[model samples]
Target: MNEPWNPYDVMPAARSADPAAAGARIDALPVSERWKRRFRLIAKAGGPRLPNLGALTFGERMAVMFSVLGLLFGPLYLLCKGLWRPALAYSLIIVAVGFAALMLGLEMLARGVGYGAAVLCANRACALYYRQRVLGERPWL
Candidate 1:
Protein backbone atom coordinates (compact mmCIF):
# COMPACT_ATOMS: atom_id res chain seq x y z
CA MET A 1 0.00 0.00 0.00
CA ASN A 2 1.15 3.51 -0.79
CA GLU A 3 1.55 6.10 1.95
CA PRO A 4 -0.82 9.04 1.82
CA TRP A 5 0.62 12.41 0.93
CA ASN A 6 0.78 15.00 3.69
CA PRO A 7 0.75 18.61 2.60
CA TYR A 8 2.13 19.76 5.95
CA ASP A 9 5.19 17.55 5.51
CA VAL A 10 5.85 18.98 2.06
CA MET A 11 5.25 22.63 3.07
CA PRO A 12 8.21 24.94 3.51
CA ALA A 13 9.65 25.37 7.02
CA ALA A 14 9.96 29.16 6.78
CA ARG A 15 7.55 31.73 5.31
CA SER A 16 10.11 34.54 4.99
CA ALA A 17 11.03 33.27 1.55
CA ASP A 18 7.41 33.83 0.53
CA PRO A 19 6.66 37.20 2.12
CA ALA A 20 3.78 37.81 -0.27
CA ALA A 21 1.80 34.86 1.09
CA ALA A 22 2.53 35.97 4.65
CA GLY A 23 1.42 39.53 3.91
CA ALA A 24 -1.61 38.23 2.12
CA ARG A 25 -2.63 36.17 5.18
CA ILE A 26 -2.13 39.12 7.51
CA ASP A 27 -3.94 41.60 5.27
CA ALA A 28 -6.88 39.30 4.71
CA LEU A 29 -8.45 40.04 8.09
CA PRO A 30 -9.04 43.06 10.37
CA VAL A 31 -7.10 43.16 13.67
CA SER A 32 -10.19 43.02 15.96
CA GLU A 33 -11.53 39.94 14.13
CA ARG A 34 -9.77 37.59 16.54
CA TRP A 35 -11.30 39.17 19.63
CA LYS A 36 -14.73 39.19 17.96
CA ARG A 37 -14.39 35.49 17.28
CA ARG A 38 -13.49 34.92 20.93
CA PHE A 39 -16.48 37.01 22.10
CA ARG A 40 -18.81 35.04 19.85
CA LEU A 41 -17.53 31.79 21.33
CA ILE A 42 -18.09 33.12 24.86
CA ALA A 43 -21.64 34.23 24.07
CA LYS A 44 -22.38 30.89 22.47
CA ALA A 45 -21.23 29.19 25.68
CA GLY A 46 -23.86 31.33 27.55
CA GLY A 47 -21.67 34.11 28.92
CA PRO A 48 -18.32 35.86 28.71
CA ARG A 49 -17.80 35.77 32.49
CA LEU A 50 -17.42 32.85 34.88
CA PRO A 51 -19.81 32.40 37.81
CA ASN A 52 -18.49 32.26 41.38
CA LEU A 53 -20.70 29.21 42.06
CA GLY A 54 -18.72 26.99 39.65
CA ALA A 55 -21.54 26.96 37.16
CA LEU A 56 -20.66 28.39 33.75
CA THR A 57 -24.34 28.72 32.87
CA PHE A 58 -27.80 28.43 34.39
CA GLY A 59 -28.42 25.10 32.70
CA GLU A 60 -25.24 23.69 34.21
CA ARG A 61 -26.33 24.75 37.70
CA MET A 62 -29.73 23.09 37.31
CA ALA A 63 -28.17 19.91 35.91
CA VAL A 64 -25.69 19.66 38.78
CA MET A 65 -28.42 20.19 41.38
CA PHE A 66 -30.66 17.57 39.79
CA SER A 67 -27.83 15.08 39.53
CA VAL A 68 -27.02 15.49 43.22
CA LEU A 69 -30.68 15.04 44.15
CA GLY A 70 -30.99 11.92 42.02
CA LEU A 71 -27.81 10.49 43.48
CA LEU A 72 -29.28 10.99 46.94
CA PHE A 73 -32.35 8.85 46.17
CA GLY A 74 -31.69 6.62 43.15
CA PRO A 75 -30.28 3.73 45.21
CA LEU A 76 -33.27 3.54 47.53
CA TYR A 77 -35.45 1.95 44.87
CA LEU A 78 -33.55 -1.31 45.19
CA LEU A 79 -33.98 -1.72 48.97
CA CYS A 80 -36.72 -3.94 50.44
CA LYS A 81 -39.62 -2.45 52.40
CA GLY A 82 -38.35 -1.11 55.70
CA LEU A 83 -39.36 0.81 58.85
CA TRP A 84 -38.96 4.54 59.48
CA ARG A 85 -35.62 4.48 61.39
CA PRO A 86 -33.65 2.40 58.90
CA ALA A 87 -35.08 4.29 55.95
CA LEU A 88 -34.41 7.63 57.62
CA ALA A 89 -30.88 6.61 58.55
CA TYR A 90 -30.20 5.36 55.06
CA SER A 91 -31.56 8.54 53.53
CA LEU A 92 -29.48 10.70 55.86
CA ILE A 93 -26.32 8.74 55.11
CA ILE A 94 -26.85 8.95 51.40
CA VAL A 95 -27.52 12.69 51.53
CA ALA A 96 -24.51 13.28 53.75
CA VAL A 97 -22.21 11.32 51.49
CA GLY A 98 -23.65 12.86 48.37
CA PHE A 99 -23.29 16.38 49.77
CA ALA A 100 -19.69 15.69 50.75
CA ALA A 101 -18.93 14.39 47.28
CA LEU A 102 -20.71 17.33 45.69
CA MET A 103 -18.79 19.77 47.86
CA LEU A 104 -15.47 18.26 46.81
CA GLY A 105 -16.53 18.28 43.18
CA LEU A 106 -17.52 21.94 43.40
CA GLU A 107 -14.27 22.85 45.14
CA MET A 108 -12.19 21.17 42.46
CA LEU A 109 -14.30 22.77 39.77
CA ALA A 110 -13.85 26.23 41.31
CA ARG A 111 -10.11 25.68 41.60
CA GLY A 112 -9.90 24.67 37.96
CA VAL A 113 -11.88 27.72 36.87
CA GLY A 114 -9.71 29.98 39.01
CA TYR A 115 -6.55 28.43 37.59
CA GLY A 116 -7.71 28.92 34.02
CA ALA A 117 -8.78 32.52 34.69
CA ALA A 118 -5.45 33.21 36.37
CA VAL A 119 -3.54 31.83 33.40
CA LEU A 120 -5.56 33.88 30.95
CA CYS A 121 -5.16 37.07 33.01
CA ALA A 122 -1.43 36.42 33.41
CA ASN A 123 -0.98 36.05 29.68
CA ARG A 124 -2.90 39.23 29.07
CA ALA A 125 -0.84 41.07 31.68
CA CYS A 126 2.42 39.82 30.18
CA ALA A 127 1.34 40.90 26.74
CA LEU A 128 0.40 44.34 28.04
CA TYR A 129 3.68 44.66 29.96
CA TYR A 130 5.72 43.88 26.87
CA ARG A 131 3.75 46.28 24.74
CA GLN A 132 4.22 49.04 27.33
CA ARG A 133 7.95 48.31 27.62
CA VAL A 134 8.56 48.21 23.88
CA LEU A 135 5.82 50.26 22.20
CA GLY A 136 5.40 53.06 24.79
CA GLU A 137 2.06 51.64 26.06
CA ARG A 138 -0.64 52.10 23.45
CA PRO A 139 -3.33 50.60 25.69
CA TRP A 140 -2.72 47.09 24.40
CA LEU A 141 -5.57 45.40 26.25
Candidate 2:
Protein backbone atom coordinates (compact mmCIF):
# COMPACT_ATOMS: atom_id res chain seq x y z
CA MET A 1 0.00 0.00 0.00
CA ASN A 2 1.21 3.48 -0.84
CA GLU A 3 1.22 6.16 1.88
CA PRO A 4 -0.14 9.63 1.25
CA TRP A 5 2.50 12.34 0.64
CA ASN A 6 1.38 14.81 3.28
CA PRO A 7 3.74 17.77 3.77
CA TYR A 8 2.85 17.75 7.45
CA ASP A 9 4.33 14.27 7.80
CA VAL A 10 7.78 15.49 6.75
CA MET A 11 7.92 18.46 9.06
CA PRO A 12 9.73 18.12 12.37
CA ALA A 13 7.76 18.33 15.60
CA ALA A 14 7.93 21.45 17.74
CA ARG A 15 11.47 22.65 18.45
CA SER A 16 11.10 21.93 22.15
CA ALA A 17 10.70 18.16 21.82
CA ASP A 18 14.44 17.52 21.53
CA PRO A 19 16.57 18.99 24.27
CA ALA A 20 19.65 19.64 22.11
CA ALA A 21 17.60 21.28 19.41
CA ALA A 22 15.77 23.26 22.04
CA GLY A 23 19.05 24.86 23.12
CA ALA A 24 19.84 25.89 19.58
CA ARG A 25 16.37 27.30 19.17
CA ILE A 26 16.67 29.22 22.38
CA ASP A 27 19.96 30.68 21.20
CA ALA A 28 18.14 32.22 18.28
CA LEU A 29 15.91 34.26 20.56
CA PRO A 30 16.41 38.03 20.54
CA VAL A 31 17.87 38.18 24.06
CA SER A 32 21.49 37.65 25.00
CA GLU A 33 22.68 34.17 24.07
CA ARG A 34 24.87 33.89 27.17
CA TRP A 35 21.90 34.53 29.44
CA LYS A 36 19.84 32.04 27.45
CA ARG A 37 22.50 29.39 27.91
CA ARG A 38 22.67 30.02 31.65
CA PHE A 39 18.90 29.86 31.97
CA ARG A 40 18.93 26.57 30.07
CA LEU A 41 21.47 25.17 32.51
CA ILE A 42 19.39 26.34 35.46
CA ALA A 43 16.24 24.72 34.08
CA LYS A 44 18.06 21.48 33.33
CA ALA A 45 19.28 21.34 36.93
CA GLY A 46 15.64 21.23 38.04
CA GLY A 47 15.23 17.79 36.37
CA PRO A 48 12.90 16.48 33.67
CA ARG A 49 9.60 17.63 35.11
CA LEU A 50 10.51 21.30 34.83
CA PRO A 51 9.97 23.35 31.71
CA ASN A 52 12.95 24.68 29.74
CA LEU A 53 14.15 28.29 29.96
CA GLY A 54 12.82 29.51 26.66
CA ALA A 55 9.96 31.27 28.40
CA LEU A 56 12.22 33.69 30.33
CA THR A 57 14.19 36.62 29.02
CA PHE A 58 17.82 37.38 29.82
CA GLY A 59 16.85 40.22 32.12
CA GLU A 60 14.46 38.00 34.02
CA ARG A 61 17.08 35.30 34.55
CA MET A 62 19.62 37.87 35.72
CA ALA A 63 17.06 39.24 38.11
CA VAL A 64 16.64 35.80 39.62
CA MET A 65 20.37 35.19 39.93
CA PHE A 66 21.01 38.57 41.48
CA SER A 67 18.17 38.11 43.90
CA VAL A 68 19.53 34.74 44.97
CA LEU A 69 23.11 35.91 45.42
CA GLY A 70 22.44 39.33 46.87
CA LEU A 71 20.06 38.54 49.68
CA LEU A 72 20.23 41.95 51.34
CA PHE A 73 19.34 43.73 48.09
CA GLY A 74 16.80 41.22 46.82
CA PRO A 75 13.79 43.10 48.05
CA LEU A 76 14.98 46.24 46.36
CA TYR A 77 15.50 44.39 43.12
CA LEU A 78 12.04 42.88 43.32
CA LEU A 79 10.53 46.22 44.10
CA CYS A 80 12.26 47.84 41.16
CA LYS A 81 10.93 45.08 38.96
CA GLY A 82 7.39 45.94 40.02
CA LEU A 83 7.14 42.82 42.16
CA TRP A 84 5.76 44.62 45.16
CA ARG A 85 3.96 41.62 46.63
CA PRO A 86 7.11 39.50 46.70
CA ALA A 87 9.11 42.36 48.20
CA LEU A 88 6.54 42.82 50.93
CA ALA A 89 6.39 39.12 51.64
CA TYR A 90 10.17 38.83 51.86
CA SER A 91 10.35 41.84 54.14
CA LEU A 92 7.70 40.38 56.39
CA ILE A 93 9.57 37.08 56.58
CA ILE A 94 12.71 38.91 57.68
CA VAL A 95 10.74 40.78 60.28
CA ALA A 96 9.15 37.59 61.62
CA VAL A 97 12.50 35.87 61.82
CA GLY A 98 13.92 38.84 63.65
CA PHE A 99 11.09 38.78 66.13
CA ALA A 100 11.46 35.08 66.74
CA ALA A 101 15.18 35.40 67.29
CA LEU A 102 14.69 38.27 69.71
CA MET A 103 12.15 36.29 71.69
CA LEU A 104 14.58 33.37 71.86
CA GLY A 105 17.46 35.62 72.93
CA LEU A 106 19.51 34.49 69.96
CA GLU A 107 20.52 37.55 67.95
CA MET A 108 23.07 35.71 65.85
CA LEU A 109 20.47 33.07 65.00
CA ALA A 110 18.30 35.82 63.62
CA ARG A 111 20.99 36.75 61.11
CA GLY A 112 21.28 33.16 59.98
CA VAL A 113 17.52 32.79 59.72
CA GLY A 114 17.25 35.99 57.75
CA TYR A 115 19.94 34.86 55.34
CA GLY A 116 18.36 31.44 54.94
CA ALA A 117 14.96 32.95 54.38
CA ALA A 118 16.41 35.26 51.76
CA VAL A 119 17.83 32.37 49.80
CA LEU A 120 14.57 30.47 49.98
CA CYS A 121 12.54 33.51 49.09
CA ALA A 122 14.79 34.26 46.14
CA ASN A 123 14.24 30.81 44.69
CA ARG A 124 10.49 30.95 45.08
CA ALA A 125 10.47 34.48 43.76
CA CYS A 126 12.35 33.35 40.67
CA ALA A 127 9.75 30.75 39.90
CA LEU A 128 6.90 33.07 40.73
CA TYR A 129 8.32 35.84 38.60
CA TYR A 130 8.88 33.47 35.72
CA ARG A 131 5.32 32.19 35.93
CA GLN A 132 3.91 35.65 36.14
CA ARG A 133 5.94 36.98 33.22
CA VAL A 134 6.02 33.97 30.93
CA LEU A 135 2.83 32.09 31.74
CA GLY A 136 0.76 35.10 32.81
CA GLU A 137 0.02 33.23 36.04
CA ARG A 138 -0.66 34.92 39.33
CA PRO A 139 1.96 34.89 42.10
CA TRP A 140 1.62 31.78 44.25
CA LEU A 141 2.75 33.67 47.34
RMSD of each: 20.6, 12.4
Model 2 per-residue lDDT tens digits across residues 1-141: 135423223333322334455455445534455435544554443412245445557775454454544355666656654456777887788788889898999989988877777676666655544333322334426
lDDT of 1 by residue, 1-141 (tens): 135423223322322212233334333323355433332322233332212325335654332222232233332321221122333454465456556756778656555543443343332332222222212223312
Q: lDDT for model 2, please.
A: 0.53
Model number with the top TM-score: 2
**Residue 15's lDDT in candidate 2:** 27
Stretches of candidate 2 exceeding 4 Å from the true structure: 1-72
Top lDDT: which candidate number? 2
Q: What is the TM-score of each candidate against the true structure?
A: 0.21, 0.52
Q: lDDT of candidate 1?
A: 0.33
